[model samples]
Target chain A: MAWEARSSPTGCINLLHGDARNSTSITVFDAKGIHTYQPGWLYVPFGEQDPHKLQRSERRLLQRDIALLSGDAGNVVRIDPAAKQLQTADGQTHAYDYLVLATGSRNAPEEVSGFAEGADHFYSEKASLALEKKLANFTGGRIVTGVASVPYRCPPAPLEFTFMLEASLRDRGLRGSTEIHYVFPINRPFPIQSVSDFVAPLLEERGVQVHTFFNTETIDPEHKIVSSLEGEDLPYDLLVLAPPHKGQQVIIDSGLGDRDGWIPTDHNTLRVKGYEDANLFAVGDATDLPVSKSGSAAHYEGHVVAETIAAEVQHRPIRELYHGRVACFLETGHGQATFLWFDYEHPPKPPKPRRLWHLEKAALNTFYWQLIPPGRV
Target chain B: MAATYQIDKTVDAKGQTCPMPVVMLAKAIKDLKPGQVLAVYATDPGAKKDIPAWANKTGNTLLETVEEPGLLTFYIKKA
Candidate 1:
């Protein structure tokens, strides 16, 4: 979305990645020290496929090489979460002086019965493509989606999937023949209560039957059946389950995680509570810090963490500090998007603000594209 | 009339937001030998505000800054 927005106006950034495989690669020995800061990219769904003018940022992606990816590359393995040493599957070792782990959260299949054991569970990338294939073969049938968890990654994603699926079905002219029902555990659409108050009416208007505030329990993959803790059996030909997301097992196993399996860190500084001398920080969805687990948190966290690294190098105190910030774009279907932004520093509880928070979610997307595409290192 | 720098080859981060022009200016000026100056013109509403503030933070001296009708002009002496 940021890339799309940046494409609207005009700009470019010079990106210097520490990974040499990255298109704009820069390498600096951690012991020696390095300090370079610029805005960066969070990959979006849009690519260069239009017949008309190609956006400058789109052109840049087309120009770059393959990325190793961040969270789910599967190449990176955890040696010891407490020790914070990562050994790649290819036998490479990296020891961080100051570590920032944005390993992100994973879903709990234990919350929903048989979801992990099924032949069609769509949790990771491998499962995603597998489900996509199943979707291709699926002609006219009932597709049921249920929320078994809350505070999931990309909070608006489930709804976005619904919208895109509806668009696809309608495009195939199977709307009448095919049935689609979305089950939400929350009574509201998503985000803050204020936005859900506005969107609940909208989701209902669009034919999405929302069952809010229901605590889900089980899914019998056989007989194409499901049952809530309330003993309601919702049958479906396909089940897109947003399972209960929890902290990584490695964190929990190594005692770095709380009871919720999340790493606890100071919300303001993003520093692990007892590990200040450890130079360890947690970002993205992994931290129990009071912020959304979206990539925006990781991106914002990267800025302050980068500053800390730079400051430690020059014997200078780290001036910049994290503000418990988060940003997100709610895709409203039909090419229109709503944006949101909030920081924890000001309010005791960040208000569910909507109607306009363009700087963090909307304009930042534009700014991100311009700055990340034509990076300045 | 103000001094115009078209930025023909490179280092033209016109119309960029906060922390970007700041990042770019730092990189551009660092490459200079000594006593070298780069004339930058930007249209972002925030760039006019950010450049001077970043200059103060990094110890780079902001020699002269001019705000014209539709453009922003900055003159910085590399420290």
Candidate 2:
């Protein structure tokens, strides 16, 4: 079996390496050589973790038997699924027996007017480092943190960042003098009802102002005001917005994705929906799955897809199926954390925040590369 | 009144968190014969609801739920 996997360093390829290394020949295409632990970005702005520690070389993470195509030769330009071929930027064409797309979503701060110039975000390494420096400055006035659109990766990230920011300010003796506001598009603090029930009171008790139903429209950088579609304006001396996200542009160029560049994916099989019989599959944030665009979802989906593909290669029955399972940890600052775990039929009921959970989250971060990329745990 | 049944297997997921308990249950139940019973002990609060939900979705029978100090035991019969 010959497999063609395209994306930045993704969990799917890693899982494929582990599952089908003997029966299948796997080739991964990724122009970018660096892979970052994205969840660690939230801790960067708070000075809790170093941004440099979050990244690793993509080549080093893969097994030696797995082929990696990097640089311009690895940059996929067009994918002709009908022809079962992929054309890279280097003018090379490669055919595949099967294809798996893991081209994850990217932050589109430019989608919101003035957002690129006005807001400091923690979605990328450069942006996170810049925000860390900006946050380290002495004074604070009005700080606002929220999102610009939905379907963003890690739904709890903005909220967790807000909580950690408040704690950081308190530690710096700026809590009393500074005003912190949280703006959200929905009516609740979080999309999940149980999690929101636990978080809302904590926000209130901490005196963090909440502005619900405030969808960010534009930012007036000159006056430091962010206007919402709901005919409201929030003024802030420092603004941090979780930029809107969209699927990769290459997906759009290939005409293989929806308007937002997300591929139509089968929720259960993790296969590309329209071309189900074509041996095409999608995973991670690139898929139009009604689940959080978090690494945990990708990891779970990766396992299912890897198993299905490996079984097909071995002429065995495909027994594995995805149940929309996702698990994520929410950091609530002050060394306390909680987690959410649920699937298609079940909704998440977050447990009470505990210091032990926080320690567990930290431990996971420490062993992420060893556990996830190797498919060891 | 304490109700008892012959437990074919007991999975002690004690001190384990979400996903682990459910994942362990899913893996353990696959080896059981039809009508065989599997018991799981967990400490995560979310497991109290998750275990039952998992049983319902997997078409298994949740025979009983017993709660003690910092512990939860779920009895599930394979479908």
Candidate 3:
């Protein structure tokens, strides 16, 4: 958003990317595995004929957008927020008037014991795809889905996966044979009380055992068991872990981020807290925004950051403040989805599962493909 | 038989997905004068429904539609 918004209106803008070729849709990644279980193509249903092709096309579109910036393709190896200077991998230094750090988050599977080596995580594109093979090979046994920590991107994903898995298992005539367990670090099924109230019964009705406050301490992958910090053990044939998440390493190296590598920012303004004079800002999963690190949150952050940058460029006061708007679709299995919309101020008011919401959720991929790379949204 | 209007621009939105066809069409149509026809060739299945919807919403008149193998074409007159 910063790249396109600042280019023609303000001045020549230079943009850099580590790799512009990869386009990740976490929601799609979650849904993609479902296709392997059943007779449906999530990508095709979502208007992405081929994900790799879509990625390449999106990269090309982004390259076209960045061409306006006149910036070279190089990975930013170092950032000095105070100095407003960045060093790229190609041995070049670029100075910026305003810096926007949107490095996003990465899976910290190592944070969980035995997770890095033993368990399969469905947070990343590659890992999520690998799960398809695991699911395909499974005959029937205990299937464990749980989170290693909170503040993971997309809070509702694990529960949604649970529903999809159950639906898939039922389709395969294995639902009765298999025992499904959903473990959460928090006491509740979801962060939002109302949504949890709405979904808890659905989970119970579907025979998914809910295990809360199960702080994942260690995974005995050898024994096929997950042990909690309190010494509670849950045995499983297959374990799907929602591993810990951390911000980009560059944020830590720049001395602009917290211990977890997430940049501390004014939640409303999105301005990096300490170095306000530097005009440094951050968005997405990289910021300590205290909101779901979902695409919708990032979209809201983008608007505020862009407005803040525009205001600074034009010598106007930055008035636009982010209200932490974010939305997610909970798949209730069998071609049904419910909309979960909330913000920092508002409690989650999720609509009931319906075909309309499912269609809207499917169409969002096309919206993402069209708007995000081009910096229009 | 109806008389064919002069075509001003044709946007090749093939291989591009849903909102992109409309997005590109919106951008292309903005450069056209009132009553000038803009044709868009799209391969995305969503465009068959989306283009007409977009045209209706934005007050543009969808003039013609042509369906061929692997592609759908739509002509819109700027309103």
TM-score of every prediction relative to native: 0.58, 0.81, 0.70
Ranking by TM-score: 2, 3, 1
Please provide, for model 1 over A260-324, each residue's C-alpha lDDT reduced to its tens digit, 9 standing for 90 to 100: 67788877677776777776766667877656666566667756655565566556777778887
Clashing pairs in 2: none
Candidate 2 per-residue lDDT over residues A1-377, each given as its tens digit: 23333334355666766666677788888877677798998888878888899888888888777788878887888888898899888999999989888888998988889998899999998999899999999497999988776768888999889888888899989999999999876555666667789899999988899986566778999999998754579999999988988888889998988777988898899889778888998888898886778888888888888889988887889989999999998988888989889987787888888998889999999999888777675
- The true-versus-predicted C-alpha distance at residue A206 of model 1, in Å, is 0.9
Tell me, by DockQ, which candidate is best. Answer: 2
Name the 10 consecutive residues with the lowest summed lDDT in model 3 chain A: A24-33
TM-scores for chain B, in order?
Answer: 0.74, 0.94, 0.92
Share of native interface contacts present in candidate 3: 0.00
B1-79 per-residue lDDT for model 3 (tens digits): 0137688998987765433466567657768888889989999776776677666655789988888899898988988
Per-model i-RMS: 21.6, 15.8, 21.6
Give the better candidate number (1 or 2) by DockQ. Answer: 2
lDDT on C-alpha atoms for all candidate structures: 0.53, 0.82, 0.66
Looking at model 1, residue A45 earns an lDDT score of 18
DockQ of each two-chain model: 0.01, 0.01, 0.01
